[model samples]
Target chain A: MAKYYQPEFECMALEDMRALQSEKLVKQVKRVYENVKYYRDLMDAKGVTPDDIKSIDDIHKLPFLTKADLRDAYPYGLLGTDLKNCVRIQSTSGTTGRRVVAFYTQADVDMWEDCCARAVTAVGGTNEDVCQVAYGYGLFTGGPGLNGGSHKVGCLTLPMSSGNTERQIQFMRDLHATILCCTPSYAAYIGETLKEMGLTPDDIDLKAGIFGAEPWTEEMRRDIEKSLGIKAYDIYGLTETSGPGVSFECEEQTGMHINEDHFYAEIIDPETGEVLPEGSKGELVFTSLDKEGFPLLRYRTRDICVLSRKKCSCGRTLIKMSKPMGRSDDMLIIRGVNVFPSQIETVLIKEGYSPNYLIEVDRVKNNDTLDVSVELSPEQFSDTVKDLAIKEKALADAIKTMLGINPKVHLVAPKTITRSEGKAVRVIDKRKLHD
Target chain B: MSVKQISVFIENKKGELAAATRYLANHNINLRALSIADTQDFGILRIICDDPKATETVLREGGYISTVTDVLAAEIEDKPGSMAAILEVLAEAHVIVEYTYAFLAPDGHAYMIFRVDDNAVASAALAGAGIKTANQEDLF
Candidate 1:
C-alpha cells in the first residue's frame, strides 16, 4: 500500500497547487528584490521588478542563474535573509575553484526536512524503524539532509557517514537498521561487503533504502535491491536549492516526485533558454518558492531531464521528474563524487606536468575505476622504471588530493595521447550507465 | 662494465610479443637472451640482442616503446650452486637487485643479468666475490 508523509500537500489538486505556488513565488520574488542586491541588480538589468512577478506565470521574465553566477556571488552575495537568521550553510564538495555555498534559515531547514520526511514516509519509514544515513557528512548535503529528515520522521537515526563499510555492516546487523539512506554506489559497496563477510541479505533487517547525490541507473537499483534485500529509492536535490529531498521517489519508482509546493521547476532549452513544454527533455531550472536565507530564482541545474504531470499509481498529484539523462557539461560523476576533467587538468598543470591527458572510467565488479594516462614531460621522463613509477604515484596523489577520490595514474611517453583538430576527446567513459 | 639491454614495453594483448619479435627478426637482429617482466596490463620484454640500436630502431618503427637500460651481467658455471654463490655476495654487500633473469649461453655457461638499484655498488660486490661482470661485446 502507498503511504505519504504529507497527504494534504502531496495530493493537492492541480489548481490549488498552482494557486499555492503562485502566491509563494510572488512573496519570494519580493523578498529577494528587497534584501538581495545581487538579484535586484539582475532583475533591474533584465527590466524585471517584484511588481512584474504577480504570479508563477511571470517566472519566465526572471533572469536565469547559472553556476557561474553562483560562483560570482560566492559566500553571501545571494543571501535573501540576514546572517543573524541563517542557522546553517551547506556547500558543494568541489575542491577545485569556488564552491557553491547555500545558506538556510530555520524555517528553510524545516521545509527541507519536511520534504525529506515525506520521502522517508513514502518508502515506509517510521519512528519504529532504524534509519542508517550513510551519505557523506559535513559540507555535502546528502548526510545531514537525510539525517535531519529521518529524525523528523521519528525514526531511530544512525548518523553514520560514508566509508568504513565493515563497520557499516556490523552496525546494520547489530542494530537491525530497517531503512538505509546513502549514495547508490556506497549502498552497492555495502551490499558487496555484506556478502564478502559471509552474510546474506536475509541476515539483515533492511526493508528500504533512499539513495541520491549521484546519478544511478535502474540496473544498479535492481542490483542493489537484490543484494541488500531492500527496495532502493532515488532522491534528488542540489546543494544550491537545498539538499537531497528536494524531490523523492515513492512506491512508484517510475520517477521522483518534486516537492512542488516548495520548489517550482521548469524545463528549458539549454542553448536558447526558452522554457520547454512539459515532458520535454532539457536543462532543469528551479525556483525556490519558500526559502529564506538562500532563495535562488530560476537557477539552471545543468541536468538534462524531463518533467511529467502524468498520473501515478502511487496516487500523489505532485509532478514527477525523470532521472537525469546526462549532464549538459563536462562534469562526470565517479563513485558518487562530481569530477570535472578541468579539475584533473588543473592538477596536472600545478604539478608541472603536461596538460594533455586522457581519463578512462570503467566499472569493474560494481565499482567505478578511474584511470588517468598523462604524457610525461621531457624533463620528468627518466630511463629508470622506478623514477617513472614514482612520478606516476606523485601525480596520482596530487589528483586524489584535488578530487577527494583516488585515480590510477599512468605516465606514458610524450605525445602519446591522440590529439584531434576540434575539442579533444579527453574522457572515455566505458561504463554503459544508461544501458 | 655491465651489458646494455633493450627493453620494449609490450601491452598485454594477443600477438603483441609476435609483433615485437617479427619486427626484430625482419631487421635480422639475433637475441642472445630475452625475458619478460609482466603485470596484468603490460609487460616489459627485456632482450640482449646482437645490435641494441637496430633492435630499438626496428621496435620503435613498428610502433613499440623501447628503451636501453644498463644492467650487470655475469657468466657463471652451469652448476646449480654457482648462481647462488654470486647472489650471496650481493646480499652480503646489502645491494638489492630490482630484477634478474638468466639464459644458458652456447658456451656451456649460464649468464645472469641483474638490474640493481646501484649498478656500481653491485659491480664492486661481484668483483669482490671474484665474479667478473660482462660487457655488451661479451654477450654478443
Candidate 2:
C-alpha cells in the first residue's frame, strides 16, 4: 500500500484542492501586493490590484515575475515579509546570469519541509530508512531541502553533501543507508565508483534513490537503476520555488506530483505570456501560495514541460508535471534547429557512451557548426584507428538522426570531459550571436 | 608467443605526443619500441616498454586512456625479405595482421611486432615455420 506524509492534502478531492488553492492564492496575492513594493509596482503598472485577484481563476490579472525582475529587485525587493521575520535563504548557482536568492521565514521553512516530507513518503521512505543526502548542502537548495525532508519523515538522515565518493560509499555501506538523494549525474558517478571498488548493488542497502537538479533521460534513469539496484525516482524543484520539494515522483515513475496546495502551477506560452491549457508543452510558471518571506506571484520558471491532471495510480490528486524538456535558457538554437542538451544526452547514453560530453556550438562562414566531444570509455576503446573512426562516425550519425543536424563527433579519452559535482556545464556557445 | 603492448589514446593536438613521452620519461620508464597511428582528431600511441604494467599505470595516472594488448614480436633478420617472410607465413595461415612495427633489440637483433586478428593462429604459424617469437620477458 502507498504511504503518505500528509494524506489529507495529497489525496484531497479535486474540488476541495482547487478550493484550497483558490483560498491560498487570494490571500497570497493580497499579502504580496501590500508587503512587496517591487511586485506592487508591477501590479500597478499592469493596472491590476488585490481586488482584481479574487481567486486562483483571476491569477491572469497579476503581473509575471521573471528572472529579469528578480535581478532588477536583487536581494530584498521581493520579500513579502519584514527582514526580521526571515530565517534563512537559499540561492541558485547563477550559471545563466545573476544569482537568485530566495528567503524563507520559520513558517515558510516548515511549509517547504512539509512538502519535501510528502515527497519522501511518496518514495516509500519512513523512520526505518537511512536517508543519505549527497546534494550540495550550502547555498544550493538540493541538500538542505532533502535533508529537512528526511528529518521530517523521521528517517536517520546523513547530511553527506556531495563529493568524497569513497567516504559516501563507506558510510552508505557501514550505516546501511536505504535511500539516496542527489543529482542524477552524481548518482551515476557513485554507481561508477561502486563498480570500480568491485562492489555490486547487493553490497549496499539502498532501495530507492531520488535524483534530480539536472535534466536526465529515461536511458540514464534505467542506467542508474541497474547500476545501483534501486528504484530511482525523479524529484523536481528550483531554488526560486523553495528548493527541490516542489514536486516529486511516486512509485509509478511517470511524472512528478506537484504540491499544489503550496504552489500553484501554470503553463504559459513563453513568447506571449498566454496561459497554455493543460497538457500543452510550454514554459512553466509558479506562484508561492503561502510563502511569507519571499512571495512571488506568477513567477516564470523558464522550464519547458507539460502539466497533466490525468488520474495517477499513486492516489495523489496534485497535478503532475512531465520531466522538464529543458530550461529555456539552456535551449540552444543551432543551424535554426531547436536543440536541447538533454536531447544530445539521450542519444549519447542510448549509444553506450558516457553522459560526460561537451557540446561546442560555433559559427563559421554564416553556418552553424555542432561539435560534440564524447569521452571514449575503456570498453569502447579500439586498438585500430579505423575502428575508432567507425565508432565516431556511427555516433555522429546517431546524433544526426536524433537532432536532424549533422554533428562532428570527437572521441576523447576517458575522464577528459569534466565530471560535474554540481550542475555540469555541457554547452559552450562560441557563436557569440548576442554580440 | 606474444608480448604485452600498451596503447595510449592521445589527442592529435600540438604537444600531446611530447606530453605523453615526457610523462614516461619522468617516471624513468624506458620504451623498447613505439609507433603512432594518427587521424585528424586523435592518435593511438602503441609502445613496447620495459614494464608494460608500470607504463600503463603511469600513463593512466597522467590522465591518458590506455589498454594492454598481446602482440606477436617475431625476431627477424635485418634483410629486406625477413619481415615479409614472417607476414607470408601468417597470410598463408589466414591470420590477418592488423598492424606491424619493427624495433632493434638491445642484443643488435631486429624484431617485428605483429598485432593480428587471431593471435593463436599467428603464433602457431610462426612456430610451424621455425620462426623465433619473443615473449613478455624476452624483450627486457
Candidate 3:
C-alpha cells in the first residue's frame, strides 16, 4: 500500500477554462510570431496576420502543422529560438523517420515539469510516492518529462529507462516504487513478463502508472491494471506538445483535461483546416502558451478526435479532449506500434501471397491483439492448402516476431474479404480498448 | 539410374532468400545441388539432397508447399568440353535438358544433376554417351 500520487483537479466548469485559454493563447501568439520563423511562414501562407489572430476563433486563419511538417524540418528546422537559450532537448522515437525534437529553456523545462506535475496531481501522485520513470531514456522525451514532473510533485524520482525488465522489477520491489511511467505497450509487456516470471504485482509496491508516448486504449488500461494490480492512466502528449503533460485523464475517466493554462488546443477539419465545433471529431491542433524555445502555431496533430470545455469531476478548469480513434493516414496504432497497414500488405505480397487481407484487432483481458487474414488465389491455394494450416501458423508467428504482437493469420477464399476499390479499411478493431 | 530432386518456390523480394534459408535452418535440412528458375513473382527451387523426405517435411513445416520429383545424375570429368560433350550427346539423342546443377562426387568425379524433358529418354541417352549414371549413395 504505497502512497504518494494524488489527483488534485477533478471537477471544474467551462467558462473559466476558456478565459485561461484566451490569456495563454494571446501570449503564445505574440511569443511565437516574434520568435519562430516556421510559424511565421505558415501564418503567411494562410494570409493570417499576427494581429488578425485576436481570439481563439481567429486561430483558424493559421495553417495546421503535422508530423510531416515536423519531419520535413528534421532535427533543427522547427526550433524557434537559439539552441543556446535551450536548456534541455527531448524527442519522440524516430520509428517512422527522424525523431521530432522539442527544446526547452530553464523556464520552459520548469513549465513542462509543472504540466507533468499537473498530470501527477491529476492522477493523485504525491511527494510521499517513490516514482519510477521507466520510459526509455536518451533523446526520447518520456523519460525526462515524467522524471522532472515527479520531482515537482515532490516524489522520490527514479530515472529508469525501459527494457531492463528484470532490473526494473527488482528496483520496484527494493525501492518500494509506488508510481510508474512508460509507454502503454511496454507497460503491458512488463505486465506479461512479470506474470511469466511468476512475480505478482503485489510483490512490488506500484499502485499507479502514467502511460504515454504511444496510443493506447482503455482496454489496455484495464489489462495493465489487472496484470500489474495498479491503477493505470493515459497522459497525452507529443514531443512538439511538451511531452506527456499537454493533457491527462482525471479521476472521472471520461477524457484528459487539457491544461489550458500552458497550451491552447483546437479541433479542425483535417482536410479543409476549418475549425470544427468542440465535440466534433477532427484533427487535433495545438499552440503552446508560455513555451519559449519552440512554440508552434496551429500545429495539426493528425490525431482525429474531439474536444470539450465542460467542467470535470476532478475540479480542473480546462478543456478535455477525447482519445484519438485513429489518424488521417494509415497510422494503425496496434498495441502502440504505429505502422501503416499497407506496410504489412507489402510484406505479405513480397512473401508471394495475395494482397487481399483483413485485420481483426481485439482485446484478451486488458491487452490488445491483432489477427491478419490473407487469401491465396485458387491455384496457389491448392498447393498451399496442404500447408495452409502450417502457413497460417508460420505467417502469424512471423508477424508476431516483427510487430511485437502475435497477429493470427487466417486463410480464406479469394474475395471473401470485403474489398473496396476506394479507401481500404485494413483494420477492424473489435476491442473495447478505447473508453 | 535414379536421383532424388525436390522442388521449392521462392518469392522475389528483398531478404526473402534469407528468410527461406532461415526456414530451412529451423527444420535442420541441408541443401545439395540447387538450381533456381525465376519469374517475376516466384521462382522454383530445384534441389537434390540426401534426405528428400526430411527436406519436404521441413519445407511444409515452414509454410511452403514443396514436392519430391525423380531426376537424372551423370558423372562427368572436370575437363574441357565436359558440358558441351554431354549436351552434344543429349542433342543427338533428341533429349532436351531444361536445367542443370552439379556437385563433386566422392570418387573424385563431378556429378551433373539434370531435369530433362523426359527422364527415361535422357537417362538412356546419357548411358549411350558412355556417361555412368549416379545413385543416391554416390551423392556424398
Q: On residues A1-435, what C-alpha lDDT tens digit does candidate 2 reach at each position?
A: 339999999999989998999999888888888898999899899999898777789988888998888888888889889899999998864322356789999999999999889988988999999999999899888899999999999999999998899999999999999999988778888998999999999999999999877666687789889999999999988778798889999989999999999999999998999998999999999999999988888999888899999999988889999988756677675543447787788889989999999999885533468999999987788789989999999999988877667999999877878878998989998866432
C-alpha TM-score for every candidate: 0.89, 0.61, 0.66
Evaluate all candidate structures by whole-model CA lDDT and list the values in order. 0.88, 0.88, 0.74
Q: Sort by DockQ, best first: what order?
A: 2, 1, 3
Cα error, residue A193 of model 2, in Å, equals: 0.9
Query: How accurate locally is residue A277 in candidate 3, as Cα lDDT from 0 to 100?
Result: 86
- How far out, in Å, is residue A189 in model 1? 3.8
User: Which tens-of-lDDT digit does each residue in B17-58 have in candidate 3?
Assistant: 788777776677667677776544345567777888888887
Predicted structure 2: lDDT:
0.88
Which ranges in model 1 have alpha carbons more than 4 Å from their true place? A1-3, A34-38, A81-84, A192-202, A349-356, A375-392, A410-421, B49-66, B104-110
* Residue-level lDDT tens digits of model 1 in A1-435: 337888999999999999999999999999999999999999999999899998889899999998888888887899998899999998886663647899999999999999999999999998899999999999889999999999999999999999999999989989999999998988999999988999999999999999998878889999999999999999999988999998899988999999999999999999999999998999999999999999999999999999999999989999999998887788888887788898899899999988899999988767889999887654563445566567778989998888888999976655668999999999999887754
Please compute DockQ, using alpha carbons, for every candidate against the native two-chain complex. Answer: 0.18, 0.44, 0.05
Report lDDT (Cα) of residue A275, candidate 1. Answer: 99
Candidate 3 local lDDT, A80-162, one digit each (tens): 67889998887654233534677888888988888888788766777788999998777667788898899988889999888
Higher-lDDT candidate of 1 and 3: 1
